[model samples]
Target chain A: MKGAVERVLRPEEIPQACDDLMKAGARLQMTYAWFPEPGQSVEVAYLAVTAPHEPFLFLRCSLPADSPHLQSLAPQIPLLGWYEREIQELCGVIFDGHPEPRPLVLHEGAHPSMPPLDPRYQPDEMMPFTSEPWDRPPVEGDDVQTLPFGPVRADVLESAQIFFYYIGEAILHCHPRLFFKHRGMEKRFEGTSPSLGVVLAERISGVDSIAHSLAYCQAIEAACGCEIPERARYLRTVLAELERLYNHLHYFGHLCHTTTLKVGEAQGKLLAEQSKQINGMLTGNRFLRGILKPGGLRRDLDLSTLPEMLNRLQPEITTYLRSMEETNSHLDRLITTGHLPLQTAYDQGATGPVKRASGIGRDLRGDHPYAAYDRLTMNIPVRTEGDAHARVQIRMEEIHESLSLIARAAKDIPEGPVSSEISYVSGGEGLGWCEGARGSTYYCVHLDDAGLLARVKIKSPSFSNWRVFPLTVHDTNMMDYAINEASFGLTMAGCDR
Target chain B: MPVWTLYGIRRGIATTSWPKKDGAVAQPEVLGLPRYHADRCRDNCRACADVCLPGALSFESCQTGERLALDYGKCIGCQLCTEACPNDALTKSNDWAFGVRNRDDLIWAEALKSPPAEEVTRKIQKYFGRSLHIRHVDAGSCNGCESELQALNNPYYNLHRLGIFFTPSPRFADLLLVTGPVTYAMQGPLRETYNAMPEPRWVMAMGTCAVSGGASGGGYSCGHGVEEFLPVDIYVPGCPPNPAAMIHALLLLLNRASQHVQGGQVAH
Candidate 1:
């Protein structure tokens, strides 16, 4: 409870404050900029907090409307490099000292030419950008060999350009260039209604629809000071847990499938299918869409269906676990592959299963405790080995934890209205964070008088975790890429959006 | 090995004689448009219209000079409307066979017409007798569709038991499952996939993004629709259509009763 630390600081003092905070043993959580209007100017805020603690210290900085430029913090905090580049690309704010300042989320010709966050920018003036002359400087030494994997590759479904440089069997350097599936989601939300913004958020990532929607809805509700019913919170938790259960199962299955482990693949598929069935039964849609509203849930869970779900899940999950246990060869392959050391994970700010596997017991559900998570008795699984096998083990254990959470939530659900009526007032800004299946998904929304969304900035788990992906694949082969990617369960759509 | 074979044999025949009959097993909730009950309506809400991703819902009140119209083609079946409807006027139906021959027929302007009570029993009995063979193509999808498509093979769903087996080579396929909005690059491959399939093969367009380019279609690289490049038999609308809905669509295509699948057949 450091009251003085909670106060926001001015722009010029941010770098020093960040350094002091880092020296004080505070983790450099994240940094982002908020623009009141595009091209008018921007106020940048850097968030720093110690691990296993709440009440983050926020340092604020402002830039002139005409010249949206700020001093780069990358030299001080190494993690700020990617965040700075993203801020520059999205908000048109120049981190003057940034090493690389290319577009992170927008394609070559898709935008209004100048920068996306500028309010003066019009849709008609937008042009597409191409990636023609991105050829890097040639290497001299014999040991340094450059390998270009994609823009087009076998495993990659979306478009991305990655260049991997290797020195003998070890990867010396790797650079990722993305923005292939940029749909201008943030720009599209500018003039739309608030309700429509919810849809936009859900579509940010097709797979993590509920998580994105929940984060967006929470932000909206907070901005409007709306209180959701008890049932809605319970429902939200159920949907989130279901998503986690399915995602982890699917990820495990993908890992197995990538390794060509037949029995493990089959077992993973069966578990994932069971999760899907539960999802379909609860909501008419398998992905659990339409259930989350700004103020509450769309509908109440049908009581009769609960018993059926229990009956189906209990026996099925048990059998699935047994089958997975029988497949030891698959487990052996994943054991020490794609290792990320504990120190590296901490330095890179890795979250979700990646962090937990590295023995950092930081789960937003347990640590932050939002929605119905506080009431539920949950176990946060951690493994000392930060390898693919540890990640697999964490996922498997979490599935059981999710089952328990779901069972408990279903059993203890209170009787109440599924939703509460919500209306908007003027000049409100609110932040909401939800522990998505992957990691902490944060949403900040500023609303106008009409209760419509004015501006929104979303930071998905993938944005934070993508920083560590290439780092972990330092010595791994190209063939192990899918296994490495699947183990992390990072969504390019979420990051790109 | 012999014991495993014996176990396989003891499990009996898992294949369903779909289309000839109906599927023996059904997903608990099949995909379709929502049903509205005007009688139970308190018309103060436009939440459904607001939450609809594709501008599918429109409402008008006569007394208050407003009217509500729903465009089935635009609906992704996200069901946010069902959550917002306080009057219990909207409910999700399991009847996924919503495809139509005419564009006008695809619209669900009025409340759903219920089948006769006696026919429900007959339909259930018939469902157990149908069998279907399917072929799936990865037509520039984000692989979300492919993931869900594979899940249909899992033990819980076990689409194979419903006579739904995905054929690798299209020559033996009864239906062609296309997933994605047909990207410019994949346009050739999509046509190749369709052309490779045998005669009397039906094309089932899965996902809203694929059906009418839900979001990705408007891009320069994306094709207008799967039908623009290939002859589609049935349209299963969703961003990435749920596996249950996918199964239902396959079943409907197998029924050979859908006019949408029957009409608009170009000789490949």
Candidate 2:
């Protein structure tokens, strides 16, 4: 409700209502869940003011599914284009005047009228829609040239499909279509208990396992009305910061690797390894799984291990940072490689490093204090360059900040039971948001009478960041694609889930 | 100009003569899977089995107490079961070389080889003599293995000094390190990778998913396990197998290869 305004409207008034909203300088952010019964269907649309510091508005409309149609919000809010397309694809609701009605989340062969997120939707029973085989469109022009890079690239990392079009030296167009390793995680979550749901969330992204799990746990905890112990809160914050550190370090190493700076890559790897070691010391698993339960933390941080953890990490971090400085080529290669204008970052609603690089000071850890974050001092790093170098510097600065926060948390370690006892409550909806390594991860949980998870909607940070990639890669050569991608560190698993 | 080389030399012999010298596990955190004590088993309790992601633990209950059977063949070294056990019955061990020739030989907990310290030390010393070259082929992994694999070269793990190195060309490789369940998309690439390797080259399926298609195998496009597509000499299981276990598997392969090269019957 911070920047959100409220409004109520009838089903027939949606088209003109949206028009009025547009005239009032408001744009559709996204449409939330649609409640559909035997004959009637009601949908909620959220609209926000386009300008900074403007309020958001929510409009509700009830219509019949047989002839369900709404006025398109694309002309007013360009960002809503993808969201609207997704709604039409999944909900089987038509946007009468929309530009494109193609599916966003589903594959080419998915059923056109199949309700994707609806409780009745069954993967095995229903026939999936099939389309003509998709082949990359060829470039047509004397100057224009098409350059296809991967499904297989030199990175020796993750797999992705990318095609870049160049008009001489400058890039004309770039399209990145993923789903090389889509595991159908969302479908798998059906019929799964909340306890098992935590595992799925953690596995969504290996690097951001703790963050995703924490978000899912928060949702369940909120629904159950579970008040986590203060010690558990501190431990959660510590783990989240540790996850952030390692992820940033890994990204830094990747950036160096792409830039062909061997020494810098080596130093970055050392830092990342140290962070992983620290994670393992804190929790038995290096990825920090099972440390978080629905109510609170699963295990208490052993005070005896603190000294050893600090002794192993602190000196190595300092030495690695110094060694990183010795390699000037790493910084040089990343300086102006992939630049996104400040406006583009804001327009795309970019979060984490992408936003920070563009000098947009938005960090959920500082803005919305959750857990032990309220007790700690938060520093938001910003750079106007908005290039690969700026992103790396922002990460490096954050890594230093995180180390300090970890030190502080460890020093002021509280004494208490790590978890609080809680019972189940039925018929409640709870929203939980956490600042994951990538950005803000939001989880919405709806519980049944038995306190089991009836429905869970997870919006990972990658969902928000993926849009910015195409925009940033605009006009840049194909070779610089890896550098830009490495800087962003987008996780396909998290997005697909 | 020579400063880098001088620094490299200054950090001399960072590589451990692992199997020979009982190479110190730089990070004890990632040693291996937790060992369960059967004496502490409770009546009708399958907590460990229930929590296990890899389906490694199986519980059979009588009137008095339940007998839990752990199959290392299925275990991913997740250690979730260890944490879930209410009693202090489960604990992790430092035994890294759990590789074997046969499917039954790979079962760690059942066989539970706890060799004497001196013997382990001698084995380590003997294994550290020859460098084992590895060729890594990612059969549609989530990049978790790639990240962890990259970490092996860091100063802390420094796998290069352990007589373990990742070869660029498959022809020179003694081991074909495969990560992830063989996906339909990567099937051709993976098969090509195996064919490119030398005749005596062993295949180490690294991770539970790679060994048995982890979690992603139940769906379409996933090709179950590497063994279905190609012969697997060893299976180092984990969600993404820890770098230590990966190194251990490589060393074990080198030992087997060395025996094979010496005109001796390589033990399965």
Candidate 3:
């Protein structure tokens, strides 16, 4: 509430408020439920944001502890569908008149009566695991067939099942059931010191470690009203860009692998490994974990050698990207594959490169300007094709921009203390956000009376994009499914968590 | 295609002769598992244990009053313990090659000592004949393990050069490599994959989560590690063990390399 403009409204006013916010050119950032007081009342918070550099608008409504019910906003705001379903299952809140209000995170094996997130529920009271038959949607046609892909897919990949209904190489509908990797990450942050909360945040999505921890630290810092050193801010920018470079490179390689470009895949992956080596050299960790804390950084890092290393790797990466762009065989498969219309992308709440590729130029780095991004200047690339090729192009251009940002930060960074003492304040709440490699990641922190974390709600970029992914696969051919998926670079761990 | 060939050739041979030669180049300026010196530890000090979020280091009441129990399998290599220690008991090192054949080999106890030195003979080579196929399963990892696992096939590592391939089917796999904390939803699928594999198959836990549930273990949704539901033959314990460490672990399983860490101490 301290960092956000807080307002209290009744359950019935939620729909009209969301409509008004959308009319004012604001979008739904996140919607989550938490127990303000353990067993007394259930509070639902909705966060909305307007264009560039606007503070978040927080809307709250209370429900009775005995029977928590709310008018479903998913009918109007399509983005709230999954969030409301998750809240209904995990927090035991009922959304009246909701369409398709089935189980989201918990399958049938979980305890039927007890909500795990409810403060009154006990962990030992969980029911035993029992196999349940999956119910498939009835579709009638001559060539219609349902194919269940995986909880365990081929190659080294995360676990999530995908249901594809198709006819002779053409897909009719696609349904992805994720959260098989949900380790209850947000629940794991409860009752822990905000310092330890950063550690848990880093593990939320391993590839987005710096972005997740940075957002978590900024939340704690904002709650305490502490300003970190200038040097730490610049170093944080460098680390975040390094993460972006490796991730985009990996995305490029995986895209190549999907397109059957063997040479291109090897070249792209080699460049990614080199970028990781640079991360290890500068931060002492390949994934750039454990360097960030609540206040600032745990220790000062020596980054004098970063610019030189980046300078050496830039040309190889450039040539590799150029070669991939020139290859017609690779470009042919991606040009018109998995086309997502502009209106559908915006309506489904797409973010990051996916949204940008569909001609929505919304980037939190240029808009919100967190972690020293305000000081650095870079162009946000946008493509109007709304296809796999456009998405790949956005990432390629982003890799070039990330390299320049890292080099500039390394050169202009000042020498000073990297951290400050964090004095935790009770009953303080703050929201922090960062534009990670994938998209914008938001972390909202609420400290309890003992100054420990009561609730930490993480709205990952993948959660939005994963919801938008199936929209593109509705009528696409099965041959291009893997390529379309590779271009999106969606991580199940990030979305499931 | 010709230009691509030229580009790759210009870069030259980037692969490292790791298992045959010293492979320090693979992990430069990187911090590995913290080395715990038993003699340097002070009595009744909980400095390291208090900050360990994953319970990798804890003070247990032993027969001799109190002792620090160190388990590399549970360590995430975050360097928090090394910074929290008042004494010089825990220090940072560059020994990234930590792959063991036994789960207990990763734990440090006063009564524990290094087992007999193993011969570097290729014991399992004849059984598998030409090459080894691996079927990787993600129990509930953070995706860091999969990231590093993908790098094994890169030009620098070129995992295929070592006669190991990641097959798409478990039926053709000789070893099952697992990552993550074995979340509840994945428990059944992981078992199904293992059951589908051929006989004489070995399992390798590739990360701290798969070894002893690094950060998100024991939560309401996930268990501690794969050992709870599956038998593991090797434990390579880093937050997400680096690409080179995974190669060492695979070779150690094949008896091509000796165990590097015993009872949480680097043998070298």
Candidate 4:
């Protein structure tokens, strides 16, 4: 991959080019279909980031609107199965010769006339209109007992149905039915001002709000060639890392909760609650919604509050993590269970702690250097075990790095305005990539002459990581399933959106 | 392993004193509801209404002049309207909690209106007077609401202290506290969960999404709020209502407490 490259290729060259790029140590970052107008040829773009921090290489190919078909790239990168099914269901882009063509985001309730995201969908058409039943994928074995987990269960954060095919206790196969929370996110971005669209993007996955909106704004800024001020960059860095802090805290709290360690769970939850309160003080919303806009930040940060918030965070976090490390009950439950092989992780494009625990040292913050991450220096922690314990270790390590990053960025914060002037002529496509708390988040924004989005495509970190679940969860003990699931810290809403 | 217990003892008590004391200060900076002043709103200026993303703020021109209407159910509390208002008509105030017993009490015209002058539902009060079991369903959410819901079980809120426990099985639930706008795929499961609950049950719509569909209300993949499919007895509005606010709503379900925030105004 070379510096900032974009080119259109014939349909036949897509798979071949993707295969070559994969061989060259490039990982598929995002894939989507773009329809500029109804009845026009469907344009598809495949974005890949090469190893050792190479520039992004964007490869595009147009399929005729009549056929709307392309050769599948799953044969090259097996994890693209989710991406392919998503585009097939939303954009009506048929993946010819693909292995699994079952519906991904769409269900029986969607109007049969057109895919929800199809350019031809009428504005007046109701979203989907029924309590649609999902077809549970067959998980075959002789003594397999089908266990449907949930679209709604216990105290799980979001809704998703996972079918575990089990013979007594050991699992034979796992088939997940997601999109129970799909809300027509991408299609709704049409015709809205980019400033308001920032709000929409933030809601793409509420936990990853800052990362998503920042990426969306970065896309618009990159398109307009607007350079954010140094102060803004540093502030963005602080906010991003702060977000990473809260999410990691939340994930750890959850991990302890899964172990049924009551005291440890409270300790973790206390830390998580403090993070939310801190976020509320810093950004006015607990989840940091509406703080990021297209040109830059929605407003300036109150510099005086930073030292106090950071001071409050450091000691509490350190104390809890220190106690957690020394606690055997907590550590024992996490060790040597829910192991995912490094090869499976890499093959599936697993990200965040999942990828780091498996020892694949690829972090978009360090690699692509979005926001002001390029200004900060830190080590990307990695663990070879790829077990539940390894995931915890990675998150704990990242929390320390994030705290250091925020402190350094805040102290050395440049003296300038927070937001910059941006001029939008509209009629270009730009890609925004950021390392969210969970993992990498990708946004592709295409704007028309009217400054409204022609199309908005997202490949959330959850979308890529969910594919790895079936591959890893298979053959794991039935009783250990909940703990293993907690290990990944998967956000069903992100995947469903 | 035994040392862990010593460590826990060293950590000591961290429980918040909300409902017991004035310790319910969960998110101090979050202004619970957006306070609206119809008079301060400049005549014929629809600036606040125009920029409202979720259509929570709206104005209609009439013979008298222009009338501004606020449906708290539709408000995600992003505060864009507060920023958009040229005058001090809409100001950012700390009024985050807006959990009410009757759904209509959420709507605002000009003044803060109280719930019906009539008496309470004696039957529900009698059934869940002391304790409440809630079964939460995420019809279709961004997980912002769910994150807050999870926090309710944390040390700060410790919801069980308030006699509300989140039961996994709907069979034991007295109230169905549902979040998210009902999505296409989730409709069947949400209804099934509600139906599974025995008689003398109530449904509380938490957050703007479940109350008025939030941003994804009429989109291609979502049904507008839970009210369309099920009977919602309470409506709590926020992008994701904070944990303290969630407790207020749950308490209001059994007539335990009166409405703290009415219309867009929060009580002192």
TM-score of chain A of each: 0.91, 0.87, 0.98, 0.96
Tens digits of per-residue lDDT for model 2 on A268-337?
6777876787777667677887578788876787756765676667675666555555666656667887
Q: Is candidate 1 or candidate 4 better by TM-score?
A: 4
TM-score of each: 0.80, 0.82, 0.97, 0.96
Name the weakest run of 10 consecutive residues (lDDT summed) in model 1 chain A: A1-10
Off by over 4 Å in 1: A1-9, A51-53, A109-111, A123-126, A129-177, A303-308, A315-319, A322-328, B1-26, B35-51, B58-70, B80-91, B98-147, B153-205, B213-235, B247-268
Q: How well does candidate 1 score on lDDT at residue A186? A: 64
Candidate 3 stretches with Cα past 4 Å from truth are: A122-127, B111-123
lDDT of each: 0.66, 0.67, 0.87, 0.81
Per-chain TM-score of candidate 2, chain B: 0.73
True contacts kept of 4: 0.71
lDDT of 3 by residue, A171-222 (tens): 9999888888887888888888898888889998999999899989998888
TM-score-superior candidate, 1 or 2: 2
Clashing residue pairs in candidate 3 are: none
Rank by TM-score (best first) = 3, 4, 2, 1
lDDT (Cα, tens digit) per residue for candidate 4, span A93-184: 88888877677778755664676676678643675456556666655657778888997877745888888888888888888888888888
Candidate 1 C-alpha lDDT tens digits along A71-100: 788876767777787777767777887665
